[model samples]
Target: MVNLLPIIKQTLLITFFVMSMMLIIEYLNVFTKGLWSKGIEKSKWKQVLLGAFLGVTPGCLGAYTAVSLFIHDIIGNGALVATMIATSGDEAFMMFTLFPEKAILLNVVIFTIAIAAGWLTDRFFKKKFYIPASDKHFHVHEIPECTGFPKNTFWHQLKHITPTRALMLMSILFFVTFITLDEHLASGSFHGILKWGHSSHSDSDPLWIKITFFTVISLSTAVIFIVNDHFLEKHLWGHIIKRHFSKIFLWTFFTLLLIALLMKHFDLHSVIQHNMFWVLVAAVLIGIIPESGPHLIFVMLFASGNLPLSILLASSIVQDGHGSLPLLAESRRSFIIVKLLNMAVGFSIGLAGLALGI
Candidate 1:
């Protein structure tokens, strides 16, 4: 029972970030009237590059951004694939700590592969995966509520906050408070709750992560404050929270918990210790998981000289941390396709590297 606490904390953190990104994107689309969407729609390669760049940014934040962008139709299947390929999830941080020089090289290779793979996916498989804007099957709920600023003053709106508004405010505040307290605790006894290797960043949380968290939370809070009753009830609460919250939370929690159980009950370490062939296979298979912690085994093994770069590369290429959980909620088909594509790429490159004795 006690073993599950850290998993809960991790799930909460992932859920909060995913929800915040969704809200932020929703706010941007409403306010900017899809200006950002229009820009990305012009060129496929442009979207692919943006996705790779975001994917390479440390942690799962960039992957979350890419998923949000894809859901809003600001990007396509190719770009999402690119983001997943380039992203090593939280394992990238561990890699940097374990083997800085090799980590740099590995990331560079993955980035290049991500770009190529993304461009190829768009060129060959675009039509098969393209979800038209009018496709209701893949559409996010669109409430016909007024999205303009409330006629009432901010204070007036605050005073008359409805249940939905109150709920949203409390949820965001709780997430913020949890993050603050977690960081403080992480610096002391709970330092490794979120990490396996020593972090390269000076702070408990990365600087850019702090910046992104605060910026998005601020925007979301401001939106909650000024949006009218209809928008709050229909769009923010109904569409964003009701449609997404439980799915993301449940999927993330169960998936992480299942992986934790597997690692605990199964003697995977000894299995990997025996054969290079099985290790390569295991690396690819585990990389299929949508969580982060499992991939760190490869990182640790590589750092300890017990695993080769080829296996680690394959694992990194296929696994994308908790970044893909939102996509899982949005469209299971898309998530499967992305993972299959990544697996193919990871295995091909992994085998090639092994052949060359990398």
Candidate 2:
């Protein structure tokens, strides 16, 4: 029973971070009107290179931006494939944060593979869009909301707190407080709660950078309180915070908790050490998970010298960060097909690397 406390704290801690991230990304997605990738879809290689560049940018933004473009018919299937291949997911940022040199090297390789694979997918699929918005099966919830400043004074606007704004404010405040308290209590005890290796950005640099960043973000939620009804409900609340935060928070918590429980009972590192097949299989299987957070396991294992380069490469190739989330939300069929292709690529590369001793 006592073991449960740290687990809960850690889970909630990660949930808070995930929630904050969703809030920011979703807000930006709404802010940009989802048309940021409009002018780049003119040529085949142009689209592929654009996707690769976006994918290699080191966050969900790249993938999400790709999804936005694809949904609007601004990019095609090949570009979509390229983006996913290039995207290292959220784990890319963490890897870069932890070991910049290795992550950068892996990213360069990924970028190269992504460009080639994207072009191949384009040639073979021979389609403009894998699952176009017109396809009866693939649907995106289109909420077209306009934004402009309201004609109210600042103090008067401060008095206006919608349910969503209040909720956002409270969540931000709770996370800020949690971070502040965690820093003071970070011993090896359960109260220290954070699973350093299990989470992202575990570099020696003062984790205080994270705290301060979130602190500024928490303060920024005041915008929610003051923004007019249209911007609040349509842009901030409906488009981003309400739509994404809860889902991301839930996924983050469950993935973390499940990984924690599994690691506790199973010696995964030992299980994979003697068996090349199991290592490759596990790498590809975990890669199939659509979310970016879970891949941190393979990364931390690699960083600790417990996992091999080839296996890590397999995971890196197969995983698409959060790039798949919009696809999963749009068309499960397309998402499944993409994952299958990536699995094949990952296995071939992983096995070939193992054979060549590379």
Candidate 3:
């Protein structure tokens, strides 16, 4: 139990950041009336650019939104390809937590590649890969009430809060309080509070990360306070929490625990060093799994200096997380095409990077 304490703390930190990010994105999407999704149907270039932009965002929400647009025929196949190509699924959240600078650079590269690949895909396969007529029309549930704020005062809403709103508000407040306490204890800013069963630890995140978490959590607290039941229930709790929370938490916890155990038990770094080429291949192959949880191993490996940038990039390029699962269901042909293109791009980049010893 004592040995697991650090891993548990790290897992919670990562999960909090990931959840906060998703909440902010959901709020923006609803508040903007899905504005970022509009005008995307006007041009192929626009579709590709918008797709890449959304894909680079740190969660599967963007991919889901893009898939919704694609199935509706609002965006073309190329746009879907770009979105999947650029998206790293939920692993992106972990990447941001573990190696933010490299994660940023990786996303930029994925964005660029996604744009070019999307453009070329449309140019060549425009006729080859059309949205099947059956899947061409589907409905995305939209809460009309979520499009704008209610006219009621914040205090009034709080006074009349529903179960969902109350739960979200209390949860956000608890997280905020916990984060503040952790920061203070880690920094020894309030040493007198140590007797409260909390340790003054040295595992504090970097200053920028601390600031980022504080700022985002504060914004989230405000969001919880302001959003009406419709938005809180339908978007935040219903979508973000229900769909994402458990998966992110479990993946992070188990991945951290497995890594910890492996390091403790064996010479894992040496094994990886001896089979770097095979490891890169495995990374690209694992990227095909479609789920975000599998690729996290590569992200963690890269963060710990046991894996190369090439392998991480390759895995990222090939995997769309669970983002493509809907596409698989809606249109198997389109899903296959996207995966084929992704594998090609991922493998080429992996080999090139290896040959150049990057």
Candidate 4:
């Protein structure tokens, strides 16, 4: 327990800092909203540029939410691809926390490449393939109520950013950490428990072992969340977390943590080292997953190793996930087709880059 204190403290501190930065950005809204609104009205090139900029940061859900907010109005269609491609997901912070030097540079490179490719694709292929039906046109007669700048004062903002919200956020972090720790702890605990049971009962089929193991894992996770919630409310941390439950921050953090755990457990580094070509192939074939977090996780894994730069660059071009699917679902068949073409072209470009050693 004593050993866990430092890790807990570090996690809490990182979470607080990230939240504070997001709050500051929200308060400013000038950069985010202004750039978005201004860029959307311009050519596809400008929209792609804006998308790339949005993607450089790790807020995949926030980006989508922003897109959804603007979908009815000011934004263009191709911008979605650009934004989705460029985002690194919130998990970059976890990389920074664990492996700062490599993760930072790798993320920067990935973001830059994704943005540039997305912008270019949007510029050349605007509305060429995927066109919405007449009833499903992309226009904004009136800006949605949620589409405007935030209207909170400095004091109001400060008042809302309390320790309770911080605590809630911390509780969420703790839950994630607990799962990782529990995985480690259970390996030993289970071995001992099974050994003890073996002496008492022979010929016990291990048929139920897999089922019970998973059940215990699921139950343990639920218990952690419940306990964290209860404890937070009973303490000052609860108020802080509650006060600052910004969806963007929460989602971003969750995404980042997921990526970190994936990398930690999956031996992604070794996979990248051996099958670098196939990894990039997967990127080109699948393009971006709908969610930025999942997409970027693959990107980061590829980037962290000696994968060919061309493959890396090419993989970044295909924007998948959040940007394409929702639009396809909205009867924008032309847009969907255009997105697929863009992805194909992006993949080709990556392949060409690899072939040319450019």
Candidate 5:
């Protein structure tokens, strides 16, 4: 139990952070669906650029948003490909938490690649997708209304609080407390697993991360006003939160625990040293999982200095940042085709890294 403490802390840190990130992103998606839909009615290149930019944003929100746009026919498959190729998935959150400098630099590279890939795919493979018509009355894109007796007043908003608003507030509180407490526990390291690389007790994330979290919190709090009860009940909280948070959290916990146990019992460093190529292979293969939890192991390994940035880049490229879930849900053919494009790009970049010693 004593030894497991670090790993437990690590897992909890990841779980809560992931949830918080999703909340913020989901809030933005719900709140800005109107603006997004309206704004994206422009050029395809603009859509691709927008998609790549969002994809490089840490956490699953950007990718998920892109997926939503694609599914709604607001964006083409090229933009979808761009988002997937650029997105590093949920692992980007942890990377930014531990190594902001490297994460940002890497994401820049990813954004460039995503833009190019998206453009090429759009230019060459342009084809109309037959999104099977849905008869369901669950309208996700309808503009929300502040349907109540009073309008935009604090009292009215407070009185008409939905379960989702309450939950977001609680999560905001939890994150604030968690960051402060975890920082104290780890002596500024904040997270035990974050201590893996650069091995410095004094190390912590950059100021931008703290700033971003606070910004997201404020934005999340404000979302209660912009998004109405129906969207919260029927879509944002009802669908995304219920569907994604638990699954991502549990999978992250177990995967970290398994890695913790493996670290306790065996020599992971030695095994990797002996089988570096095979390990890279496994990393790329695991990127195909479509879920974000398993990839944390690779992030941890990279942070521990056991893996290269290039391999991480490969995994990030190959991984669709959970944007594919909707695509997978809607049409497996589109999902597979997009993933195939991502894999090709990921491997090319990854091998180039190995070859060039990047």
Candidate 6:
């Protein structure tokens, strides 16, 4: 078990490194006065192309940042969604790191689907939802100056890559380390507890105890983000986790507890172990539940070689995760409707891919 610690640490470190690189690139784009247009003067097709390209980026936070930029007229909406679709979330990186071959194929299939879907959606809504007014156009004579960049070359780059940024990256690396380590510890603890309880105890323990335990653990994990303030910065870790802690915790606890209970009550580990597809289906269904953080657990599970089916299914469904929640939270009804629509679209695409053996 201790041998696994280094692997976990490396994974977390890489995750942080990837996120840091993304932030540096984005900041560079801003400082260089590249793609700084209050609005891009590209055609709809060009925007769609940009969106598709953005979709292949690592995570939804990157996609959302792109989306928000477009929304504020830094970019356009069509490109934003295209990028969103292309993004495979942080979990994809974990997946690729752990299971390179499978992850690569899955990502390619998903990226292709996202591009097609984003393009169609953009076109469908452009006429009615995204009508551009004549007065909305703003073309500056020269690119806007980057106030954030220093005049000196080395200092300019260094300013964007500060100690604060380094700390932020280290913090995410710590988080990934902690999560992986905690899981191993928790698994052992749970197994021990269950074994001892089974031998000595009666079946009826108060439901309240279980519920309380679940709630406390869930809340504690969720609140960890608060103490880890660096996770909230505009860097990759920060952007990904900013508003997603609660949703991820609640759903993950719910699923984990439910699975635990079923395992205990039926003594059916073998049954579940044999039927990987059902687990995959469960993971996928959970993915569609609308949070990014919990879906990451699916990647962890994949890394640990637990439920491959579930990991694959979950990865397929939970594309944008908590990144999409803000958009949904604006209106409960719309959120539900759009989420369902997205799931349906995603499922159809995934199923088709699976059927074709792609």
Q: Where does candidate 1 have its weakest 10-residue lDDT segment?
A: 137-146
How many clashing residue pairs are found in candidate 2? 1
Please give the RMSD of candidate 5 to the true structure: 4.2
Error of 4 at 221 (Å): 28
User: Per-residue lDDT tens digits of candidate 2, residues 58-170?
Assistant: 66667777776777777778788888877777666446533556777888988898898888888898755454647453433342233755557455655765677677778
- Pick by TM-score: 2 or 6, better one: 2
Estimate TM-scores for all models. 0.55, 0.70, 0.87, 0.50, 0.78, 0.54
Q: How accurate is candidate 3 locally (lDDT)?
A: 0.77
Candidate 4 deviant stretches above 4 angstroms? 1-36, 39-44, 65-78, 91-163, 166-271, 285-288, 292-325, 331-335, 338-342, 345-358
Q: How would you encode candidate 6's per-residue C-alpha lDDT over 218-316 as one tens digit per residue?
A: 443332322222332543344433433334344434434444455446544466467645655665577665545556656544433444442464355
Which digits, one per residue and each the tens of the lDDT, describe model 3 over residues 1-358?
2377766766776787788877887787667666666666779999999989878977777787887777777888788889998999888877776667778989999999999999988998766354556744444433222446766667788778788887877887777677567764355322121112234354444577667667888888778888777777878888889988998889888887887677677677888878978998888788889787988888777766667788888999999988888777877887888898999999888878878887
lDDT of 4 at 172: 52
Considering TM-score, where higher is better, how would the candidates rank from best to worst? 3, 5, 2, 1, 6, 4
Cα lDDT for residue 172, candidate 6: 56
In model 5, what are the clashing residue pairs, if there are any?
none
Per-residue error at 274 for model 2, in Å?
Answer: 2.5
What pairs collide in candidate 6? Answer: 38-73, 51-82, 55-86, 55-87, 70-75, 280-309, 280-310, 291-322, 292-322
Checking candidate 1 for backbone clashes, the offending pairs are: none
Per-structure clash totals for the candidates: 0, 1, 1, 27, 0, 9
- Give the runs in model 5 whose Cα sits over 4 Å from its true position: 34-42, 57-74, 126-151, 159-186, 196-198, 201-241
> Is candidate 2 or 5 superior in lDDT?
5
Give the number of the best model, judged by lDDT. 3
Please give the RMSD of candidate 3 to the true structure: 4.8
Given candidate 5, what's the lDDT at residue 269? Answer: 74
